[model samples]
Target chain A: MQGVNLKLDEIRKAVIEMDDVKTAQLVNTALKQGLAPQDILNNCLIPGMKEVGELFTRKEYYVPEVLLASEAFYAGFNIVSPLIKSQSTEKKTKVIIGVVKGDIHDIGKNIVKVLIEASGYDIMDLGKDVSTERFIKAVTIEKPAVLAMSSLMTTTLVHMEEVIKELIKKKMRRNIKVIVGGAPVNEEFANRIGADGYAEDAMQAVKLIKKITIG
Target chain B: MNILTIKKHGTFKVKKSTKLIDCLAKNGIPIIATCGGKGRCGSCRVRIITPQKPPAERETLFIPQSALKQGYRLACQHKITHDMTIDIPRLKKVKFTRLNANYGLALDIGTTVIKGAAVNLKTGSAEKISSVYNLQNSIGGDVLTRVGASIDGKYDILSKLLYSSLKQLKNCLGIQKPAITIIVGNPVMLSFYLHEPVNGFAQYPFTSNLNKGIFLKNPPRYVFPIIGGFVGGDTISGILQSRMHKSGKNSLYIDLGTNGEVVLIRGKNIYAASTAAGPAFEGIGVTCGSLALPGAIDRVSYAKGALRFHTIDNKTPIGLCASGLIDLLSILLERSILKDNGRLKYAVPISSRICISQNDIRKLQLAIGAIHSGIKILLHHAKTAPKNIDEVVITGEFGSRLDVNALVKIGLIPKGTKKVSFNKDLPLQGAVMAIKNNNIFHQVETIREHSIHIDLAAQPNFQEVFVASLKLAPWN
Candidate 1:
């Protein structure tokens, strides 16, 4: 308990208050005190993000506030992620997310990425306007457990299907679970496109990813 | 039938029945046709170098008198009757109707149109209101396209075109020199008016600098603080007029132009976001789309498999404006002629000559989807649901006469919008207010500083919420 002298409660409080400087300092201090990386993430950082997400849902925390908190969470995450490894002796559930081609809007994709990544998953963000071949390449290389895609414009929603078809054509579909969400995407479209699941918001997205990882 | 040669392009043969745009496009000639060959857009303009018959009434309505005298005609309306050589008018000409008064100008610069109202600064009463087409249309129709043109070094041309047009519009006030001028529009228009670099607007994390008290360097000119990224001075002006910031309860303000801006006021906090709602509501992209001018259809209803429409001036139906488009979609939904997925049961004719296409419905879907998502996101941010809002004040050309039921039917606005107030010229009114009382103008920064600029594009759940909005059925 003395080796865990680092007060995670203070770190959680800093994340809730959206204080990046304090969180970065606390995370660093906690690591120097020999607290396990897994405990630092699962107890201190993930809980902080989980609280931030809940505050977001309650409307107590808004986009800017959530953004600030995420900034703090990442400040800590940058330090803790490498050492954490999967606590269950299994590989970390890796996920990839991107906005579809022709639609460079990343507001939605960023939210899903932050929330899922904060919930203790390894996230590989492909960024916006990702091409089908690029997605095919990333999936083949990373072999992520889940592939999430977003499209804000109706014109670009078709790219999601294109990415999926490319995955199937490359015989990568069975290896990765595909989930789609965006302003123009729905569960019906997800079902029709043969995606594993669809989530409407960042909080819901994290929950969906957790469910998939657990399964 | 007649043969005509476009200046640079090759000669083409055409019949009187052939639309000039279609003829030119079919022959692989370059021309602007954002409105899908609709004469209302006035984009596909051509000048007949050879003498020809006078322009039709529709053509005269949009074309400047000087252009008409120069034998200018809209390609969408001008059909070939006899052999004539034509030239695409690259010149930007402006017409001014001088007013006889010493006053101030209040302006609302939309992406598609510019409206200027001269106020007797002493009494703070509007002397006259004059409007004209934005000259930037020749380069591009939407803000992004115009931004592209500006990024491509067309800033001077765009700025000069606007300056001359404003100069002409000022002539309508008939004042030799106005005491003051206040301009308001989306971020791009305000930036274009002053010839500022719009590079910030071209990418993510879009920034509009007007909020920091930086404005046009020219004297007797002022712009409202940029409220948030795409939501510009005009939106701040709307907030000023609505006085939503002073409210004890929750309220919503929407400026529903081509770029729909939404503001949620909860207690002392303000949240703003802009959605690219497309040009459908403004009558720029639809096949039979036109501005909210006389003879333009503003309302529509379906009865016994027939479409009944009401025009702006009780004249023959020219084209559908914003409100009429909303009504038409609702009627189609009610009659089951249009499915929730934006598919047409079949091609339905609105009038003897005008018909609705499946593509138009899809365009409307994308537009409505943008607005619906914006409202939801803002409300969510404010922690105030639609039902908690005290009032929804809509301010804009397209939003003024919009039917609440139609909007609800299409899931554009919340179903609980029982007391929606339409103030189409909120920016103009706010300008008048600022002129009458300098006290409110001082609070513009306080507003910009206090309110949060939410980048909805960054929201992780946006795709999920936006996808659900594609459905045309009423919101739950």
Candidate 2:
């Protein structure tokens, strides 16, 4: 048990160091040593990513470092995820997200998707430059608990409001929570656009989703 | 109560308290008011022969205290309270007869700078080259910002700013009128120049209105055709300049600027894409950043544990230009002062006023990553590896003074390319070629017809590739 704990700590350190190959190797070694995949994921990978998120928030880690750390996180997650059995039979909460129409910058959205998925949510990524009609269609079909939209440019952030107005027109506003995030988006802009919540970054986005949906 | 006299021109009666810039323009003496007489750009500066009014608060922003003390003031800020004789330094006495008959003008209207060349039509060579800051910079720093500004009903102001800058370029070149004028720029700039709506560029499925060679009758100017989306006539101009389409060797042509455009030639097929690399490469959005000008650090080298630097014109270093920034990054990486993930271990001070901060590295990383991913995606679409590329032609003002090895070391340029060369002004050269030879218009059409524009943002794997590319390390 002590040896397995040391291995899990090494796995976490490998991720923070952004060593994808070493992270994967350590995960494989721990699994071969009869460590449960669920224990490894709960004790190692998530905590590693959490530290990465904190480092990014503190500005010690930039986009490249965060991206690399995310890659390392995935390198270990991919090894242990398929082996872990689902403990809960309940249906997971669904979240639909996209970059607003006319804004193709999706890096922030991609990061949010990664963090949200790691946090155990079903994500239906609508992809970038998503139109208003498409967002409405996804909401009506996917019936997600939350609809998140992002835009990197000020010119395209208006599309977030357009999507919300269309949702209200279709009477889907009351059924789902609307969230907005991006470089140009702020609390006031989100409120002005009638979004239910605003998140400054991916970590905050995940927390916001959890608060609005589960609570 | 007041009279205004412009040296080398006739005196004009002026009303008291009227703005000197407005008064000068009213008297038919054109002053280059780049800020639209807002007293911002300082282009409308005049040297007063008589005792001038004390310098206004805004005048001190542009004019040195020594120059201000010597009776120089901003015309836009000055109100004519008394008779004044002033000299407009920018307006040159034009020799119209010498240049009117055989001279042709080529203008490359870029987002940051406007480059002009006076082509001797008979000789088919550029005689003089002049450049001016694109006055549209006052409206917005980048194309998308300007597009947003245009959407908000600042279209006329944008257009007027461009025209005023063009007039300034013409005056600088001392060309009264040319036999022919050819203009080339990115699609949005051309659209703005033609007074077309920029709505298409503001959204997905980006479309351009001007895709063919257009001739305007009033000024007898020919505007080059655009390819698609952000890949505009400037890329076509670069193609014409490089003759890449006719080359048998596989070649890549990249114009690095605020908008990085990459064109790949593989056998008979041509692929082009535009990447938004942001304004960092143009020395915007970074602390201690400036355009490639005198007093800008343009080169840096590390030897024997000492950092050596050179400024443009051998002047005191004020800030880092694109080339100097890349070189500094490479040195920092080599010395381990900067990590491959673009983390600056410490702020390295080059001068008392200039220090490279952590945020600067991040900005450059994004800019370089955008261009790197663009080149990679184009190569992948063409099914050609970087090693398969025979020649790479880099164009733009930033590329002119760039160290090719530093570019590769910093991973902005792929490492395995066979040959790399830089052309300082390909767009201007292409415009000159069009002016000298009418046959080039047919070639432009052929190139346009054969070219395929791939929207980088719409690519399915763009995010994945872009994330991988963000590393400040070399990759194949």
How many clashes (backbone atoms < 3 Å, residues ≥3 apart in a chain or on different chains) does model 2 have?
A: 0
TM-score, A chain, model 1: 0.91
TM-score winner: 2
| Native contacts matched by each model | 0.03, 0.65
lDDT of 2 by residue, B1-476 (tens): 68788899978898999988767655546555433455545556689999866888988866657778888887778899999899877554543223554788999998767888888989989998888767676554467766777787888877888888788788877686888899999998899888888878777778877878898886689998888989999999998899889988899998878788989999888899998887676666666566677788988899887888888888888688888898999999989999887888889998877888887788788899999999999999999899888999998656236787788889988887788888878888999989879788899888888889999988989878987788888777
Quote each prediction's TM-score.
0.62, 0.79
Structure candidate 2, residue pairs in collision: none
Model 1 lDDT tens row, A33-95? 878878888898899899889876654454555777888998888887766554457667899
Per-candidate Cα lDDT values, in order, are 0.76, 0.83
TM-score of every candidate's chain A: 0.91, 0.91
| C-alpha lDDT of residue A203 in model 2 | 89
